[model samples]
Target: MPLQTVLVTGANRGLGLEFVRQYREAGWHVIATSRPLDEGVRARDCGAELLQLDVRDEGAIHALAHALEGRKIDLLINNAGYHPGAHQLGELDYSSWQTAFHINVIAPLQIAEAFLPVIPPGGKIVNIGSRQGSMACNREGGRYLYRATKAALHSITRSLAIDLTKRGIIVVALHPGWVKTDMGTDSADIEVEESVSGMREVIADLGQHNTGHLINYDGAVIPW
Candidate 1:
């Protein structure tokens, strides 16, 4: 049997890198993308086909789609994200907020659209989202930029799930728990390995039944 192929974005470090490592270990064909080629040596060492991709570059995205025109992508993990740090209500930087939205929300959708032709029926698209995006769970409420962008990503996930239903594509948002990555900090609740493993299990079990939902790494549904 041919190996299943998974393409992960932002795979230079942290959770993205962990995903690439784990998938490669599982004997899957891993295609890992980082913004710059130099940063992706680890992914290449882990047996992934390292590609340079800055998700913000629309032309680059289309070019990649064309380059991989005949290959089938069984899974597409949209893991690139931007967290503009915690900002006070009055001191929010609009410029950084815009950047966050582009990275966290718009880029995923654009990438998905560009790669649609390569994702066969029953293929999956997992958008990395955050629990902070859940309105029902936002009690502390300080990361306005990150939170808002993730919420928008959740919305896009739902819309993509619906729109791609006819094509038999599955789209879902996954909240990898507060993991010990650069974004999650050293004090986070879990390790990158644990979070990615759990998410991989969730991805393995996904089907039409799991479409259009926000799910935690542990297989729990999160309220949006």
Candidate 2:
């Protein structure tokens, strides 16, 4: 049997890097993507094919899709994200917000759509989301841009799940816990390995039955 292939975006560090490492260790072929400046020596060392991809670049995405045309990708993880720092109640940079949405929401959807031809039936699409995106779970509010973008991502994930179900594609959103990374900060609760491991377990166990759900790394369903 051929090794399953997984393509992960933003795989230079943090959860994306860990996902690349774990999936490679599991005997899967991993295609790791990150921004042009991001040196992914770690990913290459893990035996992954490193692709320089700024998820926000439409032409680059299409180029990648064209380059890898007809290749069967078992999993596609949209893991690139941007958080323009903590925004106070009145202090919000509209420009940064737009960039955030472009990177966090629109890019993922576009990537998924562009890669559809390569993602065969039974392939999985995992969009990295956050509990901050949940309306039902939001009690304290700030960082409106990040929250809104992630919420949009969650909504898009649900729509993708519905649209792709007939094609046997499983689309789901996963909230990797607050991990200790550049985005998560050193004070964050979990390590990259722990969060990635839990998410890998969730991805491994996912099927048609698990499609369209917002799930935590530990396999718990989150309120949408």
Candidate 3:
């Protein structure tokens, strides 16, 4: 059997890096992208092909698609994201909010569009979303920038799932649990390994029956 290939964005560290590590260990072909070329050394050490990619750069995204034009991507994990720090109502940073929208919401959709030709039928595109994006799950009221962008990303995921149905491509947004990464902080709920493993399991089980939903790492469906 031919090895399956997975392309991961923001793979320099954290959950993205863990995905590259685990997939490579599972004997899959992993193409890992990071903003800085040098930061992908760890992924390269894990036997992944490293690519420098700033998800916000449209030209770079297209160039990457062109470079890997004929290669079949069994899975594409849109893991690049940005989280503007906690801000009070009056202290909100509009600039960071726009940046977050570009990285967290728009970049994923653009990347998916650029790579559409490489992803064959039955392929999967997993957008890394957050539980904070859930309108029904919002108890606290901070992180406006991050929360808003993730919500928009979830919307995009649903729309992509519907639009790509004819082509037999599966698209879903996954919340990787509160993990012990730089973004998640040390006091988070789970380790990066556990979150990535759970998400991988969910991705493996995705099909037409469950293509357009926001799912948690543990396989529970999150309310939109």
- TM-score-based ranking: 3, 1, 2
Global fold similarity of model 2 (TM-score): 0.98
Kindly provide the TM-score of model 3 when superposed on the true structure, using C-alpha atoms.
0.98
Candidate 3, pairs of clashing residues: none
What local lDDT score does residue 134 receive in model 1, on the 0 to 100 scale?
94
Q: Candidate 1 at residue 148, lDDT?
A: 89
Q: lDDT by residue for model 3 over 41-78, one digit each (tens)?
A: 99999999999999999999999999998899999999
lDDT of 1 by residue, 1-224 (tens): 67899999999999999999999999999999999999999999999999999999999999999999999999999999988865678878887877898899989999999999999999999999999899989999787888889999999999999999999999999999999999889999999999999999999999999899999999999999
lDDT (Cα atoms) of all candidates against the true structure: 0.95, 0.94, 0.95
Q: Which is the winner by TM-score between candidate 2 and candidate 3?
A: 3
TM-score of each: 0.98, 0.98, 0.98
The regions of model 1 sitting more than 4 angstroms off are none
What is the alpha-carbon lDDT of model 3 when measured against the actual structure?
Answer: 0.95
What is the alpha-carbon lDDT for the whole of candidate 2? Answer: 0.94
After superposition, which runs of candidate 3 have C-alpha atoms over 4 Å from their true positions? none
lDDT of 3 at 107: 96
